[model samples]
Each structure stands twice: as C-alpha cells, then as structure tokens.
Target: MLKIGLIGLGPIGSLHIDNLTSGAVKDAELSCVCDMRKVDNPKIADIPFYSDIDQMIKEGGADAIVIATPSFTHFELAKKCLLAGKNVLVEKPISLCTADAKKLEALAKDCGKICAVMLNQRTTPIYKRIKEMVSSGEIGKVNRVSWNMTNWFRPQIYFDMSAWRGLWKGEAGGVLINQAIHNIDAFAWIFGLPQSLRAWCKFGKYHNIEVEDEVTCYMEYPENMTATFITSSGEHPGSNRFEISGDKAYVVSEDGKLKIHKFVGGSLREFTLDTKYAFGTPETVETVEEFEGKGGQHAEVMNNFVSACLGKSKCDYDASQGVLSLTLANAMLLSSFKNSEIPVPFDDELYAKILAEKQASSELRKEVRKDFILDFKKSFR
Candidate 1:
C-alpha cells in the first residue's frame, strides 16, 4: 500500500481523510494526519496525528504528503515536503502567486519527486470531453469563449467563520481564487492561457471581506480569440454556462449537458468565401450529449497520484499546469487594480505591493470570528 501523510483537518482535508480511509483510492492509505488542533476526533481516532508538520514528516514514515492548508501556506509546506524527498499534492489554487508556485515546481524537479494539485474538476467527463472536442479540432478554430459561473454563493456567516475566509492577507483572493478557481483552471486547461487581460473586480461588495467577490474579465488569446469570465458570490440561483463559438461549430454546456451545432460541409471561413448568396450559410446539424455521475473526482486524482508514485504513470496535474490558472487570476486582479489591461505573466513585485496594502487594510478592520464546524458533505454541490 502507498502510505500517505495529510496536512490540515479542515472540511476539505477531512474529506480527503475520509476518502483514503474508505478505500476510495486504490493502493493508498492515510498513515498520518497533521494539524495544529487536537487530533482526538472520532473520525481519525486511531490514526497517527501530529500537531506539527515537521514532526509528521520526520516521524510519520509517510511516502507522500498532501497539503490541504490555507492557500498562502501551500508554498512553504509544499517546499518542505519536496526538499525532504517526499511526493506532495497540494489543493487547488496551488499557490497565491506565480513565483511561489514556480518555486515549488522547481523544488520538486530538483528533487525528482512528484508534485500534484487537487484539480479534481479535470477528471470530470464533461470537461474532459469538452477539452478533447476543442483541442481535437471538432470545434474548428474557436474564437469566442464565455463562461458565467456565478453559482458559488457564500453567506456572510461563512466569511465570519474565519478571519481569513475572504481576506486577501490569508486566502489571497475571494471568488476567483477560492471558488471559481476550478472553472478558471479549466479555462486555462481547455482554451490555453490568454495573452492579456482587462478586468473589473468588486472587493467586499457582497461580504464583509477585503478581497474581490465579484468580477468581470476580458481576456485576449493569441489565436485571434477572446474570452469573457463573469463570476460573483452575490448572485442567487445563478447559471453555470460555458459557451464556445468556432468556425465549424458552436458549443454550449450547462448542467452536465453539452449542445453542439455543426456546419455540414464547410467551416465558417470556407462558407463565407464559397457561398452563392449573400445571406445563405452552410447546412448544420445539432448534436446533444449529456453526462452523469462524478467520473472519479478527488478520488480519481488521488488514484492517479498513487499510481504515479508506484511508477505506473506520471502525475496528471503537475505543478506547472497548476500555476497556469493562478497566473490568470493574478493578471486579472492586477489589471483591476491598475484599471488597465495587463500583460500575461503579471509583475510579481507590483502584485506583492498591492497584496501588502490589502493585508494592512484588512488588519485595521475588526471582524467577528464564528466557531468553525466540520461537515464536508454540505460544503460542495
């Protein structure tokens, strides 16, 4: 069995614990868990638990470490694991910034160890099929992409549960960094990273936090394509629609159903050039596909990570892929701060300065901290 060490005991972390103990991941066992809190919980009552990360790594005898702590702590924790020659898997939004993400990636490379991200959404069939459709040229030369994923609703009490829930100093960002990150990463994974971005972000518009809760971003891709990303934590009964328009077909996916309209014989360019009449277009066919069941979400990712550890395969979500979406998040936030379109791979120092300002501002504000309850089942839909 592949021995695994886990950090953090929050909702997400505890869920990982459950999956490992439940035999949801083949050939993997949760040998140790680390958190600052007392580890007498009945869920992990018999497992070895540590209050210190270093103690867990040094004495736990784990072959791999999974970091599920806060977003800002990922870099240091992952680095520690990598330097110690242990494979590390970090939760989403791999790091708050690009430089730190790259640093962990480099450390893993230097140590020749595995570093993966819990981008379980990538394993979903809807997105995987969509990626194959677009990348495989089934949707010819996609030009316009739009996703309005605003269903990630959060109440003020959710933010009040922790001082760092929606704050920039702790979580780094609000929606785009926290909830919409899966969609953002999926965007980068399917459509490729954009060349530039212009965005308008609303900080603390819906919650009593010091980071963005609402945002609208316009991104420019290199292949003469453009994309729009609109998200918020303020909207109720929101829609999760992702649309892509291409030269040969158009696609819209919503609620696990994918709809496509394809021109019969010619691409848009070919039809425009070869059409006999001014207003006539090529014939079209409509195809609809619906997907069901979570096709190996977090469990699938863990299975793959364990397989990689056993030399059966390589890690599916490497650290490089993990940082691609984070770069976009950083760019959009920086562009909103500057009130102008910013180039891809944003300036690290400038973003740090902006984040420092927000951190200082957040420190000045007084907020109530509610007791945190652990119930991972109700956390995600």
Candidate 2:
C-alpha cells in the first residue's frame, strides 16, 4: 500500500484529510500529517502529526506527500519533498512563476519520482466529454472560443478571512491564478496554448486587496483562431458560459449542460464559397446534455495518484502539465502590466523578476478575522 503524508491544515488541506480518512481512495492510507500550526482534530488523533516538515521527512514514514499549503510555499516545499525522495501531489498553480514550476518538473524527472498537481476540474464529466468531442473533431477546426466565467463571486469578508488571500506576495495573483486557473487549465487542455495575447486586469476592483480581481484577455492561436476570456470575482449571480465556434459545429457549455450545434452542409468555408446567395445558411442539428453529479473530483485525483505510485496505471497528469496554466495566467498579467500583447513561452526570467519586484513592494496586511469558517465544497468548480 502507498502511504501518503499530507501537509497543511488550511481549508483545502482539511478537505484532503477528510477524503483520505473517509476510505474513498483505494490502496493508500494517511501515514502522517505536518503543519506549522497546532493540529487539533479527532480524525487524526491516532495518526502521526509533525509541526515541522523537515522532521516528518527525517522520520521517513510516508512514501508520498500531499502539499495543500499556501501558494507561495509550494515551490520550496515541493522541492524539499522531491529531494527527500518522496512522491508529491501539490495543489494547483504549482508555483508563482513558470521558472520555478519548470525547475520542479525537471527535478522530479531527475529524482525519478511521481509529481502531480490537484487540477481536479479535469475529472468533471462534462469537460471530459467536451475534450473528447473536440479532440475527435466533432467540432472541426475551432475558429473562436469565448468564456465568460465569473461565477466565483467573493465578498470582502472572504478576503478578510486570511492575510494571504489576495496579496501578490502571498497568492501571486487573484482570480486568474487563484480562482479561474482550473478553467484556464481546462481551456488549455481542450484548445491548447495560444500564440499571443492582449489583456486588461483590474486590481482590487471590488475588494480591498492588492491583486487583480477582474480580467479580460484576448488570445490569438494558429490558423486564424482566436479566444476571449473574461472573469471577475466581484460579480454576483455571474454566469459561467463557454462557447466554441468551429467550421463544422458550435458548442456551448453552461449551467452544468453542454449544447452542440453541428452543421450539415459542409465546412463554413465550403458553404460560404458554394452559396450563390448573400444570406445563405447551412442546415444544423443541436444536442444538449446535462450533468447532475460533480464526478469524483479531488478523491478521483488522489486515487489516480495512488495508482500511479503503485504502478497500477499511468498518472492522469503531473506538475509538468501545470506550467501552461501558470504561463497563461502570467502572460495575461504581464500583458496588462506592459499594455502590450505578450507571446506564448514568454521569458520566464522576466516574469520571475516582475513577481519579485511586486513582492518587494508589497505591504502585507493582517487578517480581519481568524475564526471565519469555510465550506470547501462550495468552492468547487
């Protein structure tokens, strides 16, 4: 059996502990847990707990480590775990910058250890089906993609719950990196990376924070394809609409439903060229699918990790795939910061330097409330 150690006791960390102890994952047991703060829970009353991660590493009980710590600490903690010869499963936005993320990826390869991230949204059935359809060319040659995903509404008290909630030095970014990264990852998973992008970001637009809470980005892909992503954390009753237009079909995913309209005549180019009339249109068929369950979510991801560690199956994905989401978020922010379109695979060093500058200039603040309780399930995408 693969013994898993979990770090951090924050909201997400608590969720991981519950999932591990609830017997949801097969062939794995919670061997130990570590956090800087005092851990007081009956769930882990019989389990080993450490205040220091180094101590946990030295004791050598767990074969794998799950890092659910704050975003800023991901790199160092993951590196330490990897160097200590432990497989790692870290939370999303692997690191603040692409450079550190890439370094972690390379080090994991060198260390010969499994390193994965918690991009659990990929397990959602609707998205999985969409990816399959797109990859199968049910939607042929995507021409345009637009997503207005602003359902992640947050109040001031939400940010006030933690000191590191919205600071660049703490969370690295706001909605783009913190809340919308899963969507960005899902988008990249289905559509792949874009060539260039222009973006606009509004920092602390609706809250008393130091990072972006609203963003609009326009990206250009190869073959004359384009995409638009708009999101905000301050909008209430916001919509989560994603649309894709291709030569043969158009797809819309929203409100836990997917709608596809397939063209009957031929490709749009062919129809346009062959039609003699100026207002000619092609015959189309529409289909809609609704989802009631959220799939396995975090539990599914951990199960995959355990099976991969035991060589039972290939890992669904690892931290190496996490770079694209981070890169996309960084590029959008960098474009807004410079007021210019940034290219894909932008200079990693430049992004790191800019992040360092922001951190250096950051005026960290204290949390307004320490007893605020959070329901992790409510935050699931």
Candidate 3:
C-alpha cells in the first residue's frame, strides 16, 4: 500500500484526505497529515501529525506527498517534495510564473519523480468524448471555436478573507489564473496550441483588487481557424457555453447540455403521407445529445493521481501539461499588459522580465496574509 502525506489542510486538502481514505485508492493510506492547523479527525489520531512538512516527510514514512497549498507557494513546496524523493501531486496553475514552472519541471525530471497537477477538467467523460470525436474526424476540420465562461463569480469577502487574494504578488493573477484556468486547459486539450494570442483585460473591474476580473482573448491557428475566450467574475446570471464549428457539423455545450447540428443532405425536400392533407416536411435534421455522471472533478483528479502513483495509468494533467496551461495564461496577461499579440510557447524570459518590471515599479507587492505566511512557515520548518 502506498502511504501518502497530505500538506495544507484547506478545503481542497481535506477533500484529498477523504478521497485517499474513502476507497478511492484501493491500496493507499493517509499515513500522515502536515498542516499548521491541528487535525481533529479521530481516524487520524494514530497517524503522525506535524506542523512541519519537512519533518513529517523525514519521519512519516510516506511514499508520496500531496501539495495543496496556495498557488504562489507551489514551486517551493513541490521542489522540496521532489528533492526528498517523494512523488508530488500539486494543485492547478503549478506556479504563479512560467519560469518557476519550467524550473520545477526540470527539477522533477532530474529527480525522476512523478509530478502531477490537479487539472480535473480533463477527467470529465463528456470532454473525453468530445476530444475523441474531434480527433476522429467526426467534427471534420474545426473552423472556429469560442468559450464564454462568465459563470464564475466571486464575492469581495472571498478576496478579503486572505491577504493574498487578488494582487499580482500573492495570487499572481486573477480570473485567468484562478478561475478560467480550467477552461483554458480544456481549450488546449481540445485544440492544439494556438499560433498566437491577443487579449484585452479590465483589471479589478468590480472588486477592489489589483488583478484582472474580466478578460477577452483571441487566438489564431493554422488553416484560418480562430478562437475567442471571454470570461469575467463580475457577471451575474452568466453563461458557461463552449461552441465549435467544423466543416461537417457544429457542436455546442451549454448549461449542462450538448447539442450537435449535422447537415443531413443537400436539397430541402418535403415528404407527404396519405394521411390528412398535410404539407411536406423538411429533409434535413439535427441531433442533440447530453450526458451525466456522478463523479465530481475533485474525485476524478484524485483517482487519476492515485492511479498514476500505482503505475496503473498515466495522468493527462501531469506537471508538463500544467505548464502548458500556465504558459497560456501568462501569455494572456502579457498580451494585455504589452498591448500586443503574444505567441504561444511564450518566451519565459519575457514573462520574467515583465514580472520583474512590475515588481520594480511597485505595481506588484508581496501582500501575503501574515497568518497564512506564519502558518506556512511553521508547516515547512
């Protein structure tokens, strides 16, 4: 059985604990939990509890570590875990910056450890089906794509709850990084990387934060295909719909329903029966489909991570995959700030330079919540 150590007992971390002990991993146990907050579960009474992550790893006898800390601290925590010869499963976005993500990826390679990210959207069966359909020519050649994800709304209290809420230094980014990242990753999974990206963003549109709340990005691909991503945290009664048009048909997923419009034939003919003197019917027809599943995203990601740890399967949302999504997000931010089209596989140096400039200009301040930082320090000591 694989013994796991969980760091950070936040909501996501607690969810992982349940999954680890809830038969999700047939041969896994939550042998240790390290967090600043004291664990209260009776089941974990016998298990080791340490406020220090490094100390826990050294003495807990764990085979893997799940790092569910804040986004800004991912790099340091993951690096430490990998260096300690432990497999790591980090939450999404990997790191606040692309350079740090790349460095972590390289470090994982050197350590020869399993580094995975929790990009749970890729585990959805509906998205899997759609990917197969598109790749198998069922949708023919994709001509255009669009995703509108304005349903993610966050209140001011959420940002105010922690000091590292919406600023560039702490959260690193706003809707694009924290909220729309799932959709952005889904986009990359459905369609390959775009040739270039251009975006316009409104920083702190509704909230009193220093990061963007609304953004619209334009992506161009080969074969004259294009895509648009529009998202906002300020919209209420919003929409979460994705549409893709191809030569053969168009597919749409909106409000938990999937619809496809496939061309039947050329001529618009009518059929008449010997019944009442009714008019003819159109020849063309359309088909609509939908799917439902019990597994939530969190459960799916946890299961996948467990499978990967057991060598039963490989994770689709590995560290490298997370890097791709993060790079795209950083590109969007760069495009907005530079007021120019940013290319895919973006230059890491350019992003680093941008960050440095922001830091130097005092535009980005390290506004970490004192309590959170103190807790984190205590956990990592």
Estimate TM-scores for all models: 0.95, 0.97, 0.88
What local lDDT does model 2 show for residue 377? Answer: 68
Q: Of models 1 and 2, which has the larger lDDT?
A: 2
lDDT against the true structure, per candidate, is: 0.88, 0.90, 0.80
Pairing residues by index, what is the TM-score of model 2?
0.97
Q: Give the per-residue Cα lDDT of candidate 2 at 119.
A: 87
Shift in Å, residue 186, candidate 1: 0.4
- Give the Å shift of residue 264 in candidate 1: 0.8
Candidate topping lDDT: 2
Q: Please give the ranking of all candidate structures by TM-score, highest first, separated by commas.
A: 2, 1, 3
Instruction: Sort all candidates by lDDT, best to worst.
Output: 2, 1, 3
Q: What is the alpha-carbon lDDT for the whole of candidate 1?
A: 0.88
* Winner by lDDT between candidate 3 and candidate 2: 2
Query: TM-score of predicted model 1?
Result: 0.95
Off by over 4 Å in 1: 39-43, 364-378
TM-score, candidate number 3: 0.88
For the record, the alpha-carbon RMSD of candidate 3 to the native fold, in angstroms, is 6.4
